[model samples]
Target: MKPRLAETPVLLGWAEAPLSPWSRFGDDEWLLDIRTAGRRADQNRISWAVELPEGAVISRTAWRGLHQAAKQFLWSMTTNPPTGRQRLSPSSVHNKSSALKTMIRWMALDGLETFSSIDAGAVERLRAWLLVRPGYKAKSITANTVVNYMIVLKDLYRQRAKLDDAPLADPLPHETTYEAAGLTPATRGSIPFIPDAIAISLLNTALQWVEEHGQTIVRAETIRREAWALGLTRGARRQCSYHARKALRRANLIGPAGEALLGAYAVRHAANHLVEACYIVIAGFVGMRVSEILSMETGAVDYHPIGETGVAQAYLVARLFKTVDQHGGRVERWIAPEPVVKAVELLEQLSASLREASGRRELFLVKNTQYGEIVPVTQMHIGWRVNDFARHVGVPMHEGKPWAFSSHQFRKTFARFIARRDRSQLFGLAEHFKHASVAMTARGYVGSDFDLRQLIDHESRAETATALDRILLSDRLAGRMGERIVVGNARFRGRAGEQVRRDYIEFVLTETDLRIHACDYGWCVFQAETSRCGGEEGPSEAGRSPSVCLSCANLVIEPRHAPYWRDRRDRNSDLLSRANTMTAAVLTEAIEQCDTVLNRVGEHDEQV
Candidate 1:
């Protein structure tokens, strides 16, 4: 008789073709013969294939490495593009070239060797050798770069072992650096930052100087140099002041109002210095990041809602590219202070003259030139320029000063001042800054003893206890647990339960997570002779030597089970409403049944 075809088994309630049994090998090698019909050979053709090749395996690793290398190259290009006396944006070309360079380097190091030929020693030696090379130590290579190389190496080895199921054992060693620990005492708070008071004074002086000089033309370079030294610092001229003004103008802080604010200085010093002063005030007062400030459009700030009478405030809300990266993927919020508002008003006034000269309405702010022309400038351009100007200024340069006044100093200063005012408002400040965590704000940007103090207090046990008392005195908790049954459990019995209750009460009163008392039985009280008597048998001990707590605990208090069954209680009213609504349609039918039963009862009484 002819052999019968095998029946397929059901999988997940559906029939499927039977899978061929796999053969196991002793040496850990998997060899399989896979076949399928092909159209290339004939009308009913079959394709036969053998083992997967090493090249195919290695190619996957190479491709992964190439992808990472390409991204790193793009990042590097964006960060430090090769601009050889060019006026064009070569970002795309530069990224391509950079990717090629990285790929070549990776191929030379990792791809030349076969998977079986490489070992842990090879990887170690490669890193050691790279470290010794010229310029390798100049700047620590980014972790991303090393990761790319390893990805390629891993792919190569994974294929070489001719194994598809197992993972490759390759450990890439990373070089330890100050940034890795997330905190390095030497640099933890050592950022070059400027103090608010000094910044305020600088803004005031610059405004005074600009006001004294009326509409006279002055060189942009001269104005920038003076503003950098007098308003910010010698070191912040190019790095902080230059960018600060540029950002101020971009943020609508240095236009017509800004110019009018420094009205008298229109002629003596360049009008641009007024613009620079406007930037300083906004940067010093608003506490916005340079990038956010730079990326701002004209309408990003609104003053109409306050009816123009509320304490001078500009609502600063904008999306910034740089701050987002630093803040661990979060947007930033800046609440412009009084001085910042005044500064923005001053800038709005100046922008009139700027627009008249440029004959443009869309381009709100621009770099002021000696020729009275406005030149376009981005945050990065102004940042480097300000740094250069700061060096020329006589402002003292000190390492680790919170306000060396980088473009970031404005944000830092704002955070510091608010922390000092009301420490409990940290969450608000964190929300304003668009930071993922207060820790991030504290670590990378914030610099002030007051901020640390406020942070410590916010997280303090004593402070939490006091706050909890205020919350408990209110009726919030009573409303939350209206009719729900609550259960408590613990692995330990008797004495353990009592100790836990005491400890829990202490902790709840002193901690942050909201909780109410769940039980009153003390482990000591239950353990000390209570169990010896029948009372100790506990409600839960129905089947065992020691009953579950439910079996004996007389402490069970069901509020609803109380005789005071006032369904009208404020807490129970909500439940009553829900029940009433659901039974409303069935009410007529229930009433009719009751009337029929009453009539039948009356008829039976008459017969008796």
Candidate 2:
């Protein structure tokens, strides 16, 4: 008999599978084909590696015992559903198994190798160890990473009953995964919204490209394909000789009604740029994930009216693969603006030849560089395009360095643009966006596609900070709330209007728990308990309901907002002359409300 080391892994062969589900794999391997795993590219490679410390070989019994537990964890993923079991993908498998591997390897060093030896105290110790390594300085592990490690322990407890070397009791029974790992709202990270200048510039350039050069790019593509199909072209311009370029150029490639595309030598590269340009327009306007955008097929965009209003709204319909299992994630819709719809239509044309060639319906297909076969473009590809597009368009620098653009920034930025104004301007900031009709822009906010409220609140606070910064410098202000602010600022800010330092204002902004919600007409210095137009979450829920806010005490009408009120008074007075008796009463009341606002700021001709 041989002595067993406490550190050696053991008992591998206990995990087994039936022939029905095992038919796809060889006797020794369980390889997963990730082609249909809601991914456009192969993303992760999952495996387990176990051994004793200092290069010592793990004994056969010990290796199999740990392997048996690892295999049982893997088997739990393969179970058929309606059984409340989850099917794993390469990404999830990689995340879960990598956690398991790290835990076991670290455990061996501590002289505990078996699942039976891992207790609740051991699990808590493992979490603490993962978060703050013994030798490393505060190279803090992210909340997500720690939470992922805790999940491995929780799962081990879940299948303990089924495994031969399973733990005797639940190792994480008292603590939930997040609680044990110390993850909370303050800990989880979020990608920041794109800076305003960069976003507006990027979107404007993208829209211009789709509007002006879209048909030219599509025409160029059609000519290249027609030449290839007729055997006039051998391959790309570089692959073919100069003779091919001259020959294609001589064809005059009259598109539709005598319109011609670019010179033959430029066709291929222009088609590629055209796709990137469309990516910015669609992704910026709609706030879709890069993967979701790549999954789209032809005619995925449409303008449909919601109710009897019959005002058309643009939307992109695509399946979100983030929650993919054997049953995939739900279909997601985005309230796209007109620019998004235009970009989508242009993309359909630009991608038509390649889509037909590949026999795949995905709109974001590109030719594989090495193989010339079409495949879906990955996030890395778009990430490169984002920076390239920024450089190409000369997007302005932020704080001295060129602003780095990413696909993730658009979603956060879009959420802020909506939240900052309570979605009053939603997509209709005509000065910036050159938006469509008011009715159409108004419809951009109402859809099943948008549910980023928590993120919006976070960003809305940021927007409020900017607003307060500007307000603190202003000498003249109006409304009851504005009067209070003026009196409040006079104390520390000095009666001479000497500027208050921004850091001091920010300190007060945070310390007092101040919230400033801006609207199209004015600002609302919100105190949820006293709000008239719905409180707390009300502005977000009602899309800022400025009509109701018009009478609220929280309203602060600045000098900048007086023009809107003056215009309102004039328009209502004009309407009263043409109104019938019942309608006349409504117009008279509207005029009175506007007069009340205009008189306070001295904008009205007649003072009350």
Candidate models: Cα lDDT each: 0.38, 0.64
Give the Cα error of residue 354 in candidate 1, in Å: 5.7
Q: Whose lDDT is greatest here? A: 2
The model with the greatest TM-score is 2
Span of 10 residues, lowest total lDDT, candidate 2:
19-28
- The digit string of per-residue lDDT tens for model 2 on 516-574 reads 76665678887777677565643433434445776566777666677778888788888
Model 1 residue 439 CA deviation in Å: 20
- Write model 1 residue lDDT over 1-608, tens digit each, in one string: 65322222211211111111332111112122221111111211111112223434345455444433333333233333344422112223332333344433543455532333455666665555444444444775544444445554444333323222112454333533322222344535533345434544454454443433322223333343345445465455345554435533333323222442222233223454455655655565455555445544445566434366464435655544431232222344455544455555555555654555676542226645565555444554455444443433333444544223466654554544433322233323344445443334443333333443443333343333433332222211111121111212332125545565445546765663332212211111123132332332121112212113223322222221122212112334444445666664444344343233223223223210
Q: How far off is residue 426 in model 2, in Å?
A: 6.1
